[model samples]
Target: MSAASERAAAAEGEQLARTLAVLRETSDRPLSFVTAGAFAALDEGGSEPLAADAESGTVIPANGLVLLYGDGGAGKTTLVLDMLVHLASGEPWLELVMPARPLRICLVENEGPRQLFRKKLARKLAKWPRAAETIRVLEEPWQGVSFRDEAQRDEFVEFVTAQKIDLLVAAPIARLGMQGGGTLDEVAEFADLVADVQRRAPGLAAMLVHHPNRAGQVSGAWEGFPDTTMHVQASGHGRTRILWQKLRWSSLLHGKTTHLLWADGESFTVDEREAVTASTMVDEILAAVLESPGASWTKLRPRVRGNETEKAAVRDRLIADGLLVNQTAREGQFRLWHADDPAATRSELRTGLERLPFPTPEREAAAVPVPPFQRSIGTVERERHGRPGSLVADCLICDHPFSVDDGSPAMRCRACVALTADLVTEREADQMRLLERLRVREALRGAA
Candidate 1:
């Protein structure tokens, strides 16, 4: 062999020997190939799904890395804290079931100070005090440890194993002292480190919180590292929506978004009503346009129930699907029409409006169905002296015409008054139901 070839062979041999030595030192059992038969014989029933609901299938995978990312002040930490609390309490979170027994968790909070974390934790524990017993927080001196440092890594593994931690939460992965500059190599190194920890402490799941890029996406190659990736965005009115951006192993939550409403300090409740299915929203939009053809977006959006972002998204989707048509009307206002309509131009729509059965303003007002109990008791008077004594006045609430004897001042009709009373009663009943639900949840927690 040539001189250079001999030197290269010797260097490769030294590197392999060092690698083998490190593996031998770190591994608890002797290294051996996992044969196909042995792998097949392994117990599959022991594996559990991470953050899953019994009915909804797998959300996140167990013993694997998961990523949660969002913009600042988007309630990412709040959501995760709630989740960990539920897991610790052995209760369900946003319908996701937890283990029957409490799971040990180590929260590495890097963004906030210890006092701030304390306040947050206190609020979360107000309802479920038992969860506090299982959760551990590691705050300061976090930067001193890095996966690249063998001693530090070993210490971390020891801590995980010693505490019997089932889950490790690293808040804002950037703060973790993983020393590479968001490169492929850095991600690979982090993944290897996580795998090592998981192997050492079986059933350990790692959740890494991260920040998105300017375009609102996972910042780097770190996206590919997690078995599941979730994105949180603020939906209006103290509510946030979580979108499953990536699910490598399971397709259960793919394309499905979960919404959470802030109920109290550090508390979130799932708003199932606001979680309207896409098909339902589409149907609502189509029906609205069918009722009021040529309605502008400004007028039609209010009739829908979703936030502005969702409304716009569904609108764009409808247009793309060719289920709805948009045309520029007078003053550049965008007018929407059902795609099945034959009206191709503004003038055509106007002409068609006259011929179509679309209800006019007066017709719509007259179409309001008045209850039999609201029939006027007074007889209609043709005229008293020179003009009719009884005049027609529209109801202040329903706009239905009612007789005003001797031109009496207009007021809400009897039917509207009854309807208003019914609405108020319904609202009170809803409030009572909500309170009952809260009480039941508290009772269940106490029982557990």
Candidate 2:
């Protein structure tokens, strides 16, 4: 036989072998596609929650993809390591619970040097030595292989299955050598590949660490790809905010933002003190409007406690929910009022009230005593802040209500006060170290 014919026959045999292998592997599995009604009727048990926080609910689903993306230096890698340690140790990660038994994890480090990765793993293991047993690192040679290729995908599935990995962690999707610049089509194709791999290895979950685009948004069609998508951003003072951007299957954590403090290089803790809830912001807005009826946007906005964006969002939500009325009071000025107030429904200002103005000194002095609404606003603000006069005051830091003497000047609770002092000392120490480093560098330069 000619050499060309022999080569052709060999290629044909290889393709046939691959086809048979797939068939044999899936022979016991059910059909892939089904009608909507049929899928709903399937007796397959509900998916169990893998990693969850008792207070915050499920984070990583038992058998789905989780996308954690952030800008560079936002501690994405560190946070992932923290999560892996918790999963492997069966401990809660930033209060997110893990299964009772340690989960087998496969960390596919594609973005950094193996030696550097080793140092990170070592630091985490120093705290929880036993977790090292369940955590596995993928071989360096296969790190850069693209999952888009069918053969490579099959090999990866085989590796995970052999290791009995329950969770897979892939760092920085860019290093995976996937084609395209994270456009919708490109991301969808990559997502399809992940689904295929998950199908082949049932009960396996994946966490993909990715970098955001120039706009600081997750690049590509990420909205539909992952079961949960978290956006991490630095919130200053060594705090990172993990916003639950998308929760497709569960509403437990929808629109909730959790804050984590970098306690050390190896782990993070949930900083409940700094974490503000949606309800708190809503109360603040309502109180502000009730305090000053027909308060203009400018006057009302600053009273609501939060960043400008959060305040605006909550205020808009109140307007949408019909709890607050935003009406034009005068040219170029809009007024906000409680929806239940009579003034909020008025088309025009009271006819004679604006005209009867400019009272004499005696009349001004005799003006009606402070109205109930006026007093209520002050009381509400004082109560919220836990002012000296209030019997119980909200902690200035965590907003926890604590007992206080009638005239005591204490603003923060005892716990918050101590935490603040420690944080201040830590900052001062860091500054001193920085100064010492600068002095040493200067002395060395002079000597040189």
Candidate 3:
């Protein structure tokens, strides 16, 4: 045979071998055979473990599943957007270094109307001109994505494959028809589906956004299935941070507990000013402590800055860092002394405290709007729900009687309290004045 024919025959044989190998790998086999193969592989020392290849350092692993979760409104969306910026600009994230080459990314969001998402995304990509070129967005609502159905999933999988998507972000798992509970098996099925997506598109990494439960944990067993788990939180004001991180493959991940200020919607930078402020706070705290050694928090409280939150945070950091110590033995005296010098303690603040009291919080959650009935309490009439007059309760101020109903509690009777935020108490000033005048006249008559 000619040399060219021999080469063609060799290529055909190689293709056939590959096809047979794939079939063998996919076919179910006896447990004993699998165990024997595993043992044989273990006995063979020549093979090496797979080398790690990250899409963006360890922040988003290549060809792996990651779940970025937080409470609602915790800036999970912001963090992911920032990540996209890094991918586009080849910029380093808080600690996650970007690869030299730019990655193609897609964000499938379901929480909002597309125009609003477009507006927000436009702001994020303002600085990076190249971002628009590589990032594909789907402002599709969660209800529209029937990922539970195989047909919908396959269509998406095909889209992912066609796009050659390096990183795919599907936010808010709740939106993707995976909203909360079914069974553990159902959760596992969802996880399997996510894995199958990766399998369908080799070298495709996914970052899923999810919300945490009341206990501050992800909703299901799917949490453990992700290759990496990032918990995002809004620390205070515009500041945000990664509350914690769990990385299975590489601890090369950054910012497990670093505060990040949103540079914009699309990016982040370390809250460096916060560090400076904290340092200043520590110095102020130290000076205050030195001025009156063993001074209670109450004593030094007056010296701290206007933001008591910063003050409390700095105090906690001091104690946590071993720069300060609480040495007050008596109750209600939260006195502080130098960690290095217990002997430098000063006298406690108060003469006596009933308990170790913390300052009452001045700030409150935004007040709930009072119902219209409560707003116009005097107008209309209160109807008794009970039989004729089973029992009656009188308004504390007006003495207006209304039948007490078991269905509603005393506190629920907003009409009586008129518990609107703007409500003012009315007093019988005229009656008091007349009584005072009468007493004065009587006294004058007696004296005369």
Candidate 4:
């Protein structure tokens, strides 16, 4: 093939079409196998096992693009930094678990340099309790320019062809061009960019750090594109949780994991998972925790109505998840915990109210007027099947009470929906206040 033909074939814009064709053809079968194989072969320098599940390695193909999106202080950077160090140290993705290969990460971050990255990297590496030098961390901008004009797209395509990256990490896709597109449409365009990247760097897993939409969706090109999509959020008060809203190839889709992250002097390290609860409980826990450096689990547990086992489980889970840490032993009492870690705290602020302790209630499967929008609440409005008032309902987000009656259609109660909305708004406002305080504190410290 001529050099020109070779360049054209390598171009992401062109290759993306071919890749989509292949995807369609193999849609009947699992495409992950091919993607995983491609990833495994692309980088084979290190054979050491890092972290894996019993069934398979923790890292796999179609591990695709792991987008970690959060607000400014959501510890997104810290999490990436920690991962870089942890992977390098050959530490397991989770405690006692091992991966088949050391995670070879390429961070196209807009932050950090050789010194800062290394200093933070060192601290995180030490916390892993594993040997350093097992992983490879590469820091470079995986650039791609976009334009409304086809000529600009083609120019950027040529640039990507020149730099054949295995894993591209882009920060805030909003900052890509000279700024002239609608935000939502830009999001769609961004999603297309991700699709394009996957085509050219077939072996690469592009992880993008982004912000969430106002309606609480993974903002940009969100019309069904991610193989795995997770929302990293903090319980308004202080606990940090990363929930998998969508997972194409894994079972973590509905899975919610709490993460306690702390900076051990430099980069943030995630400790473990915490208890899961209804959205209200999450909001309450965060509210209580953020007010003070710590809150007694004893006093807080009942607010969420967790049993002894559940409370203990949440405590233990928090410690494991790296969202909470042991503050003091007090010689002979049940250990108390605090949001002592920076990563966990930052993550909490990042997610704000999105990850509030909400429960996933069963859908009617084919209910009319989607409850949130429907104005009715009880059987008086909708027929209760001629039976006595025996209807029970709950909020889709917080599992709070909604009423059911025998009249017209289905809906949430005034008090229940109002409470949910109030809680959500309160938590959000509280986060802003907390962030403001943090900002002031930082300014004072910097001035000093």
Candidate 5:
């Protein structure tokens, strides 16, 4: 054949391929002619769908976007590290019943490296059921690689597809896509980028890690695109909890709390925070009380908001929720607020405070206390822990740790937990006493 004829034939073949691709995209249903049976014999094919009962923790489905967000040091990355180890080792995910298929994961962490990640993974997988060989890692060290414009996204997508990956994990979504929501176009485009990655890989899961907004919501337009969204936050230093902020297949809502604690070495597991309403108001009032013990309502209102009545309503609502109390006063001043009953009250406050309005970083930092003990193993010289008890633990509602008997259940520390019984009885007695004192004071004032 002539060289010119050979070139013409190659061109014709390229044109045919492009035409077929175009038709696939334009079709009402993509690749409709290829029946499910065609792929049935392949190992990747025809497995029973993931069980509806599989979802449990803050994470549910293994497909589409899964977001984990919180303030800095909220352990968003730590939780992701735990999940990655679970995926790599084939351990039963604490909340998920059906294990994800043996999958390849390409994760990008802007802050860490392959060696450190591998070390962490090794530590994690040592406790689980499977060998480390089944998991694959593609690390992008610099933060810039994942968010590189559309061209980079497309290229990365192509690279992932070529690898036949079953899962993709990207840490800190800001590094993976456009950061600011400056305009509607930018927001939509960011959402589209996330959705596009999912669409491009139907069988693969794309889990993006992001820091939560000051209000405790996920950041970026992509936040709304995920099939599941989770908020991992620290209720105390060295102790972090995970909550389901949203889920496509689960009934869990925002602030449905669960805890995950770091164990021996890098191992960690989930602890369910007893389900509670996501009450921002309740949180604010509790925070005010902690910031100022014996604070009066006049003073409390300002803590909720020094200048704004509308914002103060949030605090009033919290009082109505019974997360806070109005302790009657001795003089003309309004009642004071004392922490309500419940050992978990302070923990819940931590949960809510992390979600409050701007300047949240400072507020959250103030809430994280230095853990009393840091050594994972062995005896270190102990410093005197001042106070009346041997172990001082924070009231979950008020963040006040008190000494208690070692063997008792933790429910007693919080004033909120004892609300219905002992704690309420104590509060009522105090209230009556305060009211009597107020009446006597009024009589004196009238006489004067």
Candidate 6:
């Protein structure tokens, strides 16, 4: 090795040895112990193993690392603000009952400017004035405040410790910046930084808000470090759902979700929506099915436009429709496909069926009884996910999905339920057959 390289290595080794020596010299005697000590320690003190901090009934432990991540425009900012407001005010989170005593919370927004936060605060002020007073926002973060920058991290740790902050929010952690990387990549560096902070201030808990990658997973080493992970999603109509996706300490919140609505402009309100239950699943199923026609059970399962209450409603909506048929074909062991799709083989019957006009004549024919319980299953979807044309309905008999005429009572298309003057009796059927034979005989004689 070169002289300088060797010298540098020796210096690092000496520093490490000195640090170890200092730790050994200033440490408690016979410190390390086994499972018995852990058992006794647990038995001796501490109120509860873990308790909820900001979220009611949810335990966000002291010195815990939590990640609240979501898609780019999932309203993470609004949701996080609401959470902090509850934490500061000792209010229930969507009636989940937050900590009885409010914890001192600090939200350091690395992304949004002071103006944006003001706008947010102003919107929520009327409803959460008291909570707003307790929560603190740091507009200007110290330069180079990152795990990669030890000095800045140390300063932040000191700040958190001195302020007696309970929860510290680090937003868009990418802004924190990393120095270099290890074998495990950038996430390891982030974890190290967080560890350093926790060591300095044991009472300080961290909640990092981050964005998802293209594949919809939290970017970087977030999953590796945080003891708890909450997946946030925007469910449209200014509504957001924060799914407590994983928690290392507790299973009470596993698969549990909370919905938050952000109503802004002219007026502002943050409200907790009711969780989807069995009764509500039917409505959710109807809305989703309306959005996506011909969507099979497998496709509809993951497309949770609304919360899941009844698992069975996924298939029941179509089964209830009774108008549309499952032309879904199976590919190999598990994959399913739409059977009527030309991608497989275009059936002449299906083509003819789709081309037929709406059943205007069938509804007009008074003699024939209209099918009982005619559900106008709106426009036949050209492709499974294609937009529904105005007033779409399906044919009952041939299972042909068709567009219904506006204000039409007919469920079946004209082609499916052929319009005859009246329901044929046995003698009428025989007379019709005899007339057909006589016409064929005359045609043959003329040809000869």
The true-structure Cα RMSD of candidate 6 reads: 14.2
lDDT of 1 by residue, 1-448 (tens): 9999997688557646755876787796766788899998888842777566556455555677888899888998888988888888877776644454577888888766668778878878888788888998875574444444455567778998898887888877776655556788777766776676777677788888888888888777786678778899989869998888877755767666878789876778877774565666788899999989877788888788766787788887877666776654232245688877765332344432212222233443454554222323233334333433344455665555554445444355434433332322445644544554453343334334
**Superior by lDDT: candidate 1 or candidate 6:** 1
List model 5 lDDT by residue over 379-447, tens digit each: 222235332213334444444443333222232233433332223456764464455445334333433
- Candidate 2 residues lying further than 4 Å off, grouped into runs, are 1-42, 53-58, 274-296, 299-303, 306-448
User: Per-residue CA lDDT of candidate 3, range 1-448, in tens?
Assistant: 9999997688557646754875698786745546766877675421221122233335456677778888777788777887776776555556554444577787788776677778888887787778888888864444377455556667778888898777888877876756348357777756666766677777778888887777877777664677778888878877787754677755555324667876644567876543436778888898887778667788897886536887888887776666776654443345576655645332254222111222111211122232111111122222442222122333344444333333222222223232211122234433433454453343334334
Candidates sorted by lDDT, best first: 2, 1, 3, 6, 5, 4
Off by over 4 Å in 5: 1-63, 96-100, 113-115, 125-131, 140-144, 147-155, 182-184, 252-255, 272-448
Output the TM-score of candidate 6. Answer: 0.56
Select the stronger candidate by TM-score from 2 and 6.
Answer: 2
lDDT of 3: 0.60
Candidate 1: the clashing residue pairs are none
Clash pairs, model 6 backbone: 52-58, 52-59, 56-97, 56-98, 327-339, 378-392, 379-392, 379-393
lDDT of 4 by residue, 300-378 (tens): 5665544567556655555555555433233212223345434122224442112222222333323444544322322
Compared with the true structure, the alpha-carbon lDDT of candidate 6 equals 0.58
Per-residue lDDT of 123-200 in model 6, one digit per residue for the tens? 876687787666777656533345555566777788777877777887777676643322355577566567667767
- CA-lDDT, candidates in order: 0.68, 0.69, 0.60, 0.48, 0.53, 0.58
Leading candidate by lDDT: 2
Clashes of 4: 45
Q: Which scores higher on lDDT, 3 or 4?
A: 3
lDDT for model 4 comes to: 0.48
Scanning candidate 3 in windows of ten residues, the lowest lDDT window is 359-368
TM-score of 3: 0.54
In model 3, where do residues sit more than 4 Å from their true spots?
1-27, 30-57, 139-143, 182-184, 252-255, 264-266, 273-288, 296-448
Candidate 2, residues 1-448, lDDT tens digits: the string is 9999997688557646765877798797977887999988877742666676565456677678999999888888888888888888887666555464588898888866778888878888988887888888877575565665567779879988999888988877887755578778778767766777888888888999888888889977678778889899888868888888887655767667788888866578888764455788898888988899867678887776677787788877887677887654233344677877765653334321111122232432344343111101112223444542323444555555444433333455545443332333445644544554453343334334
